[model samples]
Structure formats: C-alpha cells, structure tokens
Target: MAITMTKGQTGLTGNAAIAVAMKQINPDVCAAYPITPSTTVIEDFSSYVADGKVTTELITVESEHSAMSACIGASAAGARVMTATSAQGLALMWEMLYIASGMRLPIILTNVNRALSAPINIHCDHSDSMGARDSGWIQIYSETVQEGYDNLIQAVRIAEDERVLLPAMVCLDGFITSHAIENIALLEDEDVKKFVGEYRAQNSLLDTDKPSTYGAMTLPDVYINFKHQQSQAIARAKEVVIEVGKEFGKKFGRTYALFDAYRLEDAEAAIVILNSAAGTTKVAVDELRKQGKLVGALRPRLFRPFPFKEIADALSHVKAIAVLDRADSMSGFGGPVFNEVRSALYDADKRPKVMSRIYGLGGRDYKVKDALGVFNELQKVLETGKVETLQKYITI
Candidate 1:
C-alpha cells in the first residue's frame, strides 16, 4: 500500500465525489434511473459521458429494476459495471439484486439512503438499505462526504476480488451527505486508476473459449448449495474488505475500518449508531466527557457481513449500551441493527445490557441533545441493572 498525494483536492458534494470516483475508476458500463438524492450521481456521471470525459457505456434505464438488470447483463458479459438508486428505486430492484449477487456479478452500486414511502417522503432514512441487508450484497455506510467518496473507490476493489466476487453498495444518508457540500481530498485520476486497477472477468458469459451457464434454475438440493457458496463468499468479504481499506488508506491517506470507535476503551456506557448521526453522537460524547461522564460512541461502517464478534468485543467492557437505528425492523422486538447487536452479544461471558433507540425517520432532525438523551437512558439502565424499555423511539 503506497500513499499518493494528488494536487487536485477540492470541495465537493457527496454526489459529485461519487461521480468523480466513477470517472477515475472508469468502469466499462453504467446503467441507472433517476431518483432523488441518488439521481445526481447518475446525472453527473451521464454529463461526463456526454462530454466524452469517460469511455463508459452509459445506459439510461426506464426503471431501477431495469437499471440493475442492465448492469447484471454487462457485468456477466465481463464488463466492470455500476449503478445508483434510492428509496423505491431500490425497492423496484429487489428481485434483480438477488440475481446480481447470486450470479456472483461484482457490480458496484451507490445507494443514497432515503425513507420508504406510504406517506411518501423524499427524505433520509436507513429503511431502504436495511431492507436489503440480507440480499447477499456487501454494504458499507458513509458518515461524511469524504467517506462516501473514499468508500465508493474502495468498493470496486472489494467487489471485484476473486475471493469475494459479490455485488457491493456504498451508502450515504439521502439529502444529508448526498446533497451537502463539504471539503474532500481527492486522489489524482491516475492514482485512482492505478488503485482500482483494470477489472478482469473470471467466468464471463463472453468467454466463448470456456463457456458457462449462469442464473440457471436449480433443484432444492443444488439451490441450497449455491446459496451456501454465496454465504461463504460474503464471509470471505470481511477479510477482503479490511485488506482493501488498509491498502486504500496507505495509498490515499484516509484510513477506514469495519466501524469507527470513539472514546469507548474505558467508557462505562456507549451508543452504537451509523451514518451522519454518529457525528452528532460524537459531539454529545465530547460534551459528556467534559462533565467527567464515561460516555462513548460506535459507528459501524460495514453492515453486511455484520462484524458480530468484533462488535461484541468492542462493547464487552461497557456496562450499558444503546443501539440507535434510523429504521425500524417492525419485528415487534427491535430495529435490524439492534437485533444483530443483541444476538452478537448473547453468548458473551460479560455482556452489556443493550437497548434499542429508533430515530430520524423521513429525515427528521437529530441533534446533540437527542444523542445525549440516549446516553442518559443508558446511564439509567446501568444504575438500575435493568432495561425498562428494550426498544423506544426518539422524539425531536
């Protein structure tokens, strides 16, 4: 891993950063449909293609499902492929998403996290991506514009790795990170090109010399086995993700981890979260620390391949823990992340009492006070040796 400093660092929105990353990686094909929050990624990248800025074969699909379908075809034909979508756009692609990963296509997707509709909102939430958590795609959440940019570049290498040839998504909070302007250090075009490297297909449909079948209907016996292999590949992706992130850091000077732990080492209580809200929680933690409170925060970057053991270890020392989720699982128990974290610590010898807090649905504002309130609840649980509510929603 060699670090390269580029002279082209500039201020960019997360969507612009995504487009810039795509231009540098220069995938063979990109297929997408227009959807809010994520639409800019497609719009910007399309302009690049229109201006002859990249050699990518851009396809403007009519719907998100078709966009993913086109990407799957291009990827199976041995082309590096990419796409972007949000909210119901992601919902429409649900069926094809399984096909992409089950066929082992290394397609990269930028999913701008947005609220699911019934009341119909075009705001930020984790509902879209969390619904696809079990879809067999590797998922990475971004906390800032810079992380959004860096993660997209790293996702290419991770998805295309021979040992982990599965589709991956780099997710950013919908209007928050995606549309917000922020300063970011960019890698020179040549550096990103060198970093991502040229993609080579191993079992491509185009390889007439060694022809193969894909997505073939299988009997129960064979279907289960194929699913087993997909499981193994995602399991292997955990290591590949770490290796790629480390290499990316060495080359680009921005280190990434499965999750970012803040002031957790000696803390007695902590809040676990993801995406932009983690930054607010950090501020709350800092304020609490000033008052000599042992408060900490954990923000998970990797959601799929859900680093269970590592998370359990990270929280093992705390007496009480609260997992804050932007989406509800509606399972009558807790949110998706809360369930996973609780399950992860079930077998630990000295497990902390964990509670779940759901907040910010449909782009509701979450401030430092909201985070501090969660911390205060955790402190109460610590003092009482019991959790009054296993799951609760944050108001305002």
Candidate 2:
C-alpha cells in the first residue's frame, strides 16, 4: 500500500504535534509521567483515550522511572509501547533506558529538551538529551514542529526494522520549539497507517507457544558478544534512517535526510548544528551568502548514528567549519558535535579545519548575529589559525 498526502493543516505546538502523531500510530500501551514541556504530549494522549478516540492502555505513573518500567513490561508482553519525558524525568529513567534497548523493545519516545538542574531551570536546552547520549537507543533531533511530527512516525519504522529492533527517541527543544506554536502540515491517518503499518514482533518474550527468556544476566565471556551484537544493530540503523526518511518523504512530500544541507554545495564555510539553533544559523548563512561570503549551514537530523559519512562529504569542499553545540562536556576537550565532526574528517585526504563554539546553554538566547560571529571567527581560523574559546553558560 502507498501512502498519500493531504492538504489539511493545523496550527499546533511541537508537543501537540507529537501527541497527534502518537494517536495516529495507535500504540497498544502508553506509559508516561507528567513533566514540563513534555507533559502536554501525554496529557493530549490521555484525553484521546478518555474521549474514545483511541483504545489503548494509558498508564500514568507517579515517576518517570516507573513510567519507563511499565513500558518495558507492556512491550515485553508483545504490545507496541510509547512514552515522553524531559530533564529530571529523563534522568530518572536512565536505568530502564538501557534495559528497554538491551531487551530490543521497539518503544518510541520523545524527549523535550530542557536544562538539567543544579539550581533547577525549566527552559529550552540540550542538557537533557545530551545526558542520555550513551543510552542504547536511536536518537534524532528535530529543528521544527513539523519535523518532530514527521520524525516520530519514521522513528517507529527505523526502530522496528528486522535488522534493527531497538528503541528510538525523537528530541525537540523544550520551550523554544516544543511549546512554540507553528503551522504544521500533518500526514493523514491513512497515509501514516500505510507508512508505518502494524507492529510485528519477531522474537517477543510474551509469545506463549514460543516462550523465551529475556533480560537475562550473562557472564563476562558472553556479555562481550551481546554488546558487539547491540553495536552492530545500531551501526545498521544509519541506513535504515535514511531509507525510512526517503519513504516518509515519498509518502508525505516532506524530505529529511540524516543531515540536511542548506546552500553547502560550493560554499567556502559552513556552521554545523543540531535542533532549533539550526534555524538561526540558516538565517546567518543566508545573510552571509548575500554579502558575497560563501557560507552555508549543515543541520544534523539524526544524532545517535552521528551521520559521519554524510557530514564529511558535505564539508569536504569547505575551507573551515564551526560546530555550534548547545551543551558542554565540562571534562571533554570539546562539545559533542565538535568531537564528532573532528573525528569524521580526521582521516580525510582534504578536510575543513573545524572549530567548536559552545553557545545557548541553560536556555540562553542565541541570535543570528551570534551565528554570524562564529562564522567570522571560522573565517579567521581558516586565514590565521587562531580563535578564542567562549566560556560555558555565556550566550556570546
């Protein structure tokens, strides 16, 4: 069956877009806890369940940890499961986050990006999502409300693929994008149903006739092999993300590769970013290019697999690249994107000299001018090989 697009449109927040997508997917079970920025998604889902729009088990747990635990059980029972959370809530679910993927459950989740607390701030940032970067799940960041809605649908297909049966997380900036209202063109129910069909469990523990043990604790000798298998599955998901994205575009007329390039074809410099900041960087890129400066922007749509090959190829012709990271590593030598970009181009015969600029931490505002400043600094780095490091928690 082929999915077809419709012209229906709605003014919706990123949170609401996610809820709408989840309702369309029609999961068998939804277990979630209420957390700021992400609360509206589950709230909308609960309303759907109450109004008879969706017939599913909606479990509202007292804490985020319990929410994920319940989802694991529901998924192990051969049911499609889903949930949403942010910041502290995500930190609470850390242990189960590992278990959900290790068990190979095709659970889909959304992490509305928010700042992690030392003093407790509740606004848009990447701290929450960055904290869970090492968890065994496919992670994709959306720069706009429409992308968030579309990615949630594609994430299921990527996670449930036979070759890559792991959980996936669709992340959006907490208040900046998640709460901001936008005109979003959503896929019709028929199109979504055709694109992401019924959930088929290949080796679920809940199968009665073919009973199998799950979450088994293994000895050291066998544990290495399990880790190796998990790594291979994640590595294979890179191709699945690209394929599913293409299929989604073919069905809905909206295309998003693992990394989207804006005017980067023959540009001399480019800014690499993820999430909502990409929107601002694009503006800077446009202005710079208009002034006879050959600048462009590279926005990473998928973060977990890192999209190293595409990133390297995209920046191969550029002279210098500036990686804007919203979160900091503290102990690491550079930001997450900076680390990945450097690693991706280190062995190339000809590659751009990259600089890491930390910005927009703790929900600080990042304007287009800030992006331009980074681009200017990148030009300076290319010309003279000298650039200053911006301290943490400062906007500019």
Candidate 3:
C-alpha cells in the first residue's frame, strides 16, 4: 500500500497529538505516572480531566509498576484501560507487563522510546521496548507525530479484538518525534467513538453474577498449554492489525500495514529500518533514485509478532540489504532487527545478502548524509557480490 497522508491540524507535538487521541477515546480508566518526553501526554490529558471533558477516571500512581498494576485491575473489571511511560519506567513495569498480557487484559499503552540508563541518558533508543520484545505485548513503532496518534487509536481495536486479547504498546521515539511539532489531522470525536465502539470485555471481574478469576497460578502440567494458547492469539493479530488499518482508511483515509515499503519493488539495494528514521532514509532513497541507483527502504511498523514471511517476500528481489537498529544488542553479534530479518530470509527462494548496522544511540543524529552513506555501501555490496563487514556502527 502507498503511504497515505492526511493533513489539517498543524504544529502539534507528538505528545500532544497522542493526548488528543486519548481525550477522544475517553476510555473508562487511565492509570498514569510521569516520565520525561511522555510526561506532557498525561499533563495535557489531566487538564481535560480537570475540565470534565472526558469521563475517564484518572488514577495517579507512585511508579510505573503501580500504574500498570492499576491498568490490569481496571481491565479485569471490564473497564477500557490505558497508560503511558518511557525507558526506566517501562523497565520497572517489566514484571507486571507479563501479568497484563498473560491474562489477556487488552490494555493500551503509549511508550515513548528512550535509552535505558546505566550511563544516565534520557534520549531516544529502542532498548526499552526491545528489552520487552518477548514480554508478549503487541509492539507498533511510529515514524511521526501523525503515526503515533494514528497507531494508538487503532491499537484499541487491535488489542481488544476477541481473537487477539493482548496489551499493545504504541511507541514513538522519545525527545525526537515525542517533542517535535508536526502536521497531523484528527478524526471527528463522534467518528472515533463509533469506530472503537464500546469495549465489552467477555469476562468482567466486576460481574459478581458470573464470577471469574484472574492471574491464577497454574501447575507445570497445564502451564505450557496455556502459553501455547497465548502464543496463538498473538499469531492471529497480524491479520487483525491489517483489517483494522483498512477499516480505518475507509473511514479516516489513512491506512496502515505490517510494514511500509518505499521505492523497494524491483530495487537492487534496500535499507530495512524502524520508526522515525524511515523518514530520513526515504529522503536518501529518493536522492539515490534520482541518480539512477536502484535503492529502496522498508520500515517495519509492527515489531512483535513480526511478519517474517511477508517481509521475506517483499525483499526477495533485492540484491543486498542493510538493516539498521537504534540500539545495540550487546551480544557481540548484531542488533535485534538485523538478526530477525536475516533469519526471516533463511527460507526464501532467493535470499539477498544482508548486513547489520547500529546507529542513533541515546538520540544521536541520523541525517540524510548518514543514510546516503549506508546506501552507498549497499551499492558497493551489489557490485562485488560480497558483504565485507557483517556488522558495524554508523552515524557516530
């Protein structure tokens, strides 16, 4: 699908756009705690709360763990729940994250991507969300303020679907997209209300008439079986995400998919990336195409429950590829996205040569020049039919 654009409202920061989405959603409950880059999301929503603009019951908590805990409880009670956090805040909620997903809470969370601390950085990176990649939450990365807003709105339908009752994290790069003002258009309040509809959880804890239990301990005999079901549910979400995207487009005119591909078809070289960097890389791709180079870009929007086969097919024709990651894997091998993309191509009929590159750690600049350099390297790989270095750092 081509990149869909909707323009109307302008000069809204990513955080503010997300807040507007939340206000329009008017969920039953909101569990909030403050963290940089994402703090204003809550602050702006709180003003709406103060003015009685939304009927949501806002619960102020002490920590991110407590925040997620409250979301689990509210969701179990049949209330549509949501929250927001970043980096270390997400780390603190790690334990609770499992309980939310494992129990099928279908809560919506907006995680502003930030670098995890040891050397104390408060900037953009994928380490926070990457660490929880296996935590069973559906992950969607956004490339701009518009996507961040759009994704969160769609996430409500995706997570709440009966076939895929799992929590979802709509992640936007912290201090980058999160702080940058950009063009965006919001759907009408009534339209958003009609689209999401009213959340009717099948098994509400508050229904004393039909009593139910949550987070009950299971013995090893049946534990693996329960996990298998959870795994299958996430596996089914890939289709639901696409379905919702289409419906959203029919209504709002901006459709999304598993991943967004630009100038990739019939290209000789391509760059595989995620989130906001795709915008910069696309500029590089346009420049190279003008120079008579066959190059392209593919940005994976959905991260968890990765579309391995779909991605493999999309990239089958390329002669060589460069997969860029915002965070280092620290395994002395390559970044997380590189490993997964390489593995995906293992079964392809014509597997292209793929290499890994890490960049933009702690919010380092990834300009068009840096992307041009990567594309230049890909051109060399196409000429020699060899990848000199399997992995390296870029844009330092």
Candidate 4:
C-alpha cells in the first residue's frame, strides 16, 4: 500500500510527534509502561488505541521490565512490536534488551533520553541510552522534534530489515525535545503505512509447521557463535540503515545519513557532538565562520554501529577537534561519545588533535555561547599545536 503526506506543517513536541508516528505505522502491538518525559509518548499512543485510530494492541504492563518482556513475546509471535521509556525505565529493561536482540526480534523502542539515578534526575542526558550501547540494539539518535518523528519511522524499517533483525532504540533528549514543540511535517497515514510497509517476520515461534525454541541457553563456544552472528548482523545493519534512509528520503522530503555534518568540509577545526546540542554547536560553527574561522561541527545520527571510518574521514582534514558529550562516561579519561569519536580517528591519514568536553548532564543548558567557548578552545589547540587539557568539564 503506497502512502502520501500532508501539504502543511504543524507544531509538535518530540513525544507527540513520535506518538503520532506510532499511530501512523499502527503496529500490531505496543507494550508500554509510563515514565517521566517519555510518559506522554505512551499516553498519546494509548489514546489513539482507545479512539480506534490504529489497530495496535496496547499492552499496559506492570513495570518497565515487563513492558520489554511483553514486547519480546509479541515480537516472537510475529507481531510488529514497539514501546517507549526513559532513564530508570530504560535501565529496567536492560535484561530483556539483550534477550530481545539475542532472539533477533525487531522491536522498535523510542527512548526519551534521561539521566540515570543517584541524587535522582528526571531531565535529559545520553547516559541512559549510552549505558545500553552494547546491549545489541540498533541505536538511532534524534537531534530535534522533526528528526525524532522521522527517525522513529525510519527505525522501524531499519530494525525489521531482514539483514538487521535486531531491536532498535530511537533516542531523543528527554524533556528538552520531549516537551518542546516545533513545526514539523506530518505524513499522510496511508503514505507512512506505505513507507513502513507490512511486517514480514522470517522466523516465528508461532509457526506450528516449523517449531523452534527461543531463549535457550547455549554452551560455551555455542554462545560465542551466537554472538558472532549478532556481530555480523549489527555490522550489516549499518548498510541497511543507509539504504532505508535513502529510500525514506526518496518518499519523503527529508534525507538522513549516518551523521549530520555542518560546514565540516575543508574545516581546520571542528566539534563532534550528538542529539539536540549539535544544533547549538552548528550555531557556534556559523558564528566562527563569519569571523573567517575555518570551523565546523559534526553530529552523529547513528551511535550504535558508531560509523567509525566515515566519522574519522569527515574530521581528518581538521587540525583540531573537540568532542562534546552530554553524559560523562566517568572512565576518568573522557565522555562516552568523546572516547568513541577519538578512537574512530586513530587510523586516520592525518589524525586531528582530539579532546573531550563533558557538559549538560541532567538537562543542563548547552547554549550557543557554551559551544563558542569550546570552539574558542579548539582554535587555541589549532594555533598552539597542543591540547592544553585533553579532557575536561565544560559547564561544571
């Protein structure tokens, strides 16, 4: 069934946009438990279910773990499944996350990113999703309300693609994008249905003719073999993500890539960042450009597969690079994004002097001025040919 889009745009919060996208895709099942910031996503989608806007089976479960557990069960039964959560809720699903991916279930989860507890924070941060980076889920991060809407729809196709029959997490900063509204285009439901197409499960626990056992314990080497297969599938997912992104672009007006680059070509210095803060960094890039500074910014849209080579090549031309992370990895060296981005550039033909700056935990504001300060430091690194401080906190 081919789909179409509306001619105009409307303002929508990140949570609402995603809820609307879920309504359009109209999955067979949605197993959800409410949590802050992300609560609205499930709330709105449930309202759609109540109003008969979609044919989805809304399974309201007891806890976050049960929510993912139900999703795993529904997906194994060959139903297209989806869910939403944030912070502690995401942490609660940690155990089932591995189960879902290991079982090769393509469940799509929209994670409104929030800080993990201890002193307790209900605000935005990448820590929650970042902590699950190796949970074997395809992670696609959104930088805006519009991107949140687009990414969730694209994530469904990416996760369910045969080559990448892996669970996927579509992440957006909590409260920030989750509550903030922005003008975005809404696709005609029929058109989105056409784009996402129908769910085609290759293996089903419910297929009586060919019975199978799921979640069975594997022996020593057998477990490694399973992991090897999972590794290959995630590697294959990078290509699937690119292909689906192009196809989504072809049908819709917006195009997506592994990452979004802002004025990085021929740049002498750059900032590597993610999510909503990337927008701020881009403003800093523009301000620096007007002053005849050769600066740019790179924001990763896909963090799971890490896009190592592509990311490295994009920043290799720069003489100095500053990587920003919203959550500190607490590894003593740098933040998670900084570590990954720095590691990616190791084999570059001309590796730039890379440094890490951790900022904006607990929904702290990362204004353009903060970005400008980071760039100003990068400029010093460019001129001095030395990193005064390889890693440091920016707004602390």
Q: What is the per-residue lDDT of model 4 for residues 1-396, given as tens digits with 9 covering 90 to 100? A: 633444598889999999999999999999999999899999999999999999999999999999999999999989999999999999999999999999999999999999999869999889999999999999999999999999999999999988889999999999889999888998999889999999988878899999988899899969999999999999999998899889888889789999999998979999988899998888888888999999999999999888998898888889999999988888899999888889988998888999999899988899999999998898899889999999998877
Q: In candidate 1, residue 58 scores what lDDT?
A: 99
lDDT at residue 236 of model 3 (Cα atoms): 97
Model 1 steric clash pairs: none
Could you give me the TM-score of model 1 versus the true structure? 0.97
Give the Å error, residue 344, model 1. Answer: 0.6
Comparing 1 and 2 on TM-score, the stronger one: 1
RMSD of each: 3.5, 3.9, 3.1, 3.6
lDDT string for model 3 (143-228, tens) is 99999999999999999999999999999999899999887888899998999999999999989999998988899999999899
- Which portions of model 1 miss their true places by more than 4 Å? 1-8
- Between candidates 3 and 4, the one scoring higher on lDDT is 3
Query: For model 1, what is the C-alpha lDDT against the true structure?
Result: 0.93
C-alpha lDDT (0 to 100) for residue 325 of candidate 1:
92
Per-residue lDDT value at 280 in model 3: 98
Q: Which candidate leads in lDDT?
A: 3
Model 3 residue runs over 4 Å out of place are 1-7
Model 3 pairs whose backbones collide: none
Q: Tens-digit lDDT track for model 2 on 159-218?
A: 999999999999999989989988889878888878889897877677889998888889
Location of the lowest summed lDDT over 10 successive residues in candidate 2: 385-394
